[model samples]
Target: MEMLIVVAIIAILIAIAIPTFASSLNKARIATDEANIRAGYADVMVNVLLDDNYDAENGNASTAGQTKYYLQKDGSVATTDTNAYKTQGKNDSATTEIAGQKVGAWAKDKKVTYQYDNTKNQAVISFE
Candidate 1:
């Protein structure tokens, strides 16, 4: 009888813990995704600013946890490292939209390829 009670208690504890653990895992995943996107955007912008037809190159060097960013391809392939975070929706609406530019910040991909176009013509290049 005592063993049965203990088993039931253990089962109850596991049931209560599973949902909480799952929730935490989800939150952490979302946080990591957000961080990756922001980092990707920053890297892309830095590479763009370094774009000088004379002195600096238009492409960015590959980071430790990030891919190489390029303004426009010049018949050469872009470089990429093993992205620490592999998340879905990297090429979804977030990356494909002009308003969101979410793809600009996706770190899950191998290459941060960008088409330099200011559809808004606001003169300010930002992800937000």
Candidate 2:
């Protein structure tokens, strides 16, 4: 009877732990996605500065872990993807179309903001 009780307890613990572990893994994925997108934004800025073409769009170099990137063009960004030259929406909005994409704003409602700071000559990707 004691052995059966131990087995039951162990089974219960495993069942509980598995979902929690899965949840944490998902959260980690979201964080990774956010970082990837920010990196993409930085890449675009570097390319723009180096090439002297602010009108061109650049994407993320990451081939895995959610394909998210900023699509910049004409000194403004829209995540539409309709034009292929420029994507429509903001950070969170833009990410929805991309697989495994998670925007701070979309995921946590008040976590993400993407901005272009012309004064600093930088594309500022920040989270709330």
Candidate 3:
């Protein structure tokens, strides 16, 4: 009887923990996404201040520097022309090379990117 009670208690605890763990994991994902976006935005704006490659009508920035401007990603998956980034809106403009990370795991088939808005002279985030 004592062993059975222990087993039952363990099972109950596991069941309760599973959902709570899942929810916590999701919350962590959201927090990570927010942090990545904020930091990435700052990175892009800093690049703009240091870069001299802006053109009035082109809406572009340089990619030839030591660091490629994919913003948050690094290593191999960084520069691929795959779903890591979505090309739409003014992002498809020939002059602009948008830089940002994939959106949070809560979202699929989407990415967050940064581009310098020449008219406004500010870095803007775009979701695509």
**Which model scores highest in TM-score?**
3
Off by over 4 Å in 3: 53-70, 75-109, 118-121
| Model 3: ten consecutive residues of lowest lDDT | 87-96
Residues 69-117, candidate 2, lDDT per residue (tens digit)? Answer: 2343333333333322222223335444222233334443223324444
Model 1 Cα lDDT, one tens digit per residue, 1-128: 99999999999999999999976776675565455545555555555454443122323322311333332222222233333334423322344333253334443333334333333311122221
Alpha-carbon RMSD, candidate 3: 9.3
Clash count of each predicted structure? 3, 7, 0
Model 1: clashing residue pairs? 94-102, 94-103, 95-103
Per-model TM-score versus the true fold: 0.49, 0.45, 0.53
Residue pairs whose backbone atoms clash in candidate 3: none
Q: What is the Å distance of residue 8 in model 1 from its true position? A: 0.1
Cα displacement (Å) at residue 64, model 2: 26
Which regions in candidate 2 have their CA more than 4 angstroms from the true location? 51-105, 108-115, 124-128
Cand. 1 Cα-lDDT:
0.42
Considering lDDT, where higher is better, how would the candidates rank from best to worst? 3, 2, 1
Candidate 3 local accuracy as lDDT?
A: 0.51
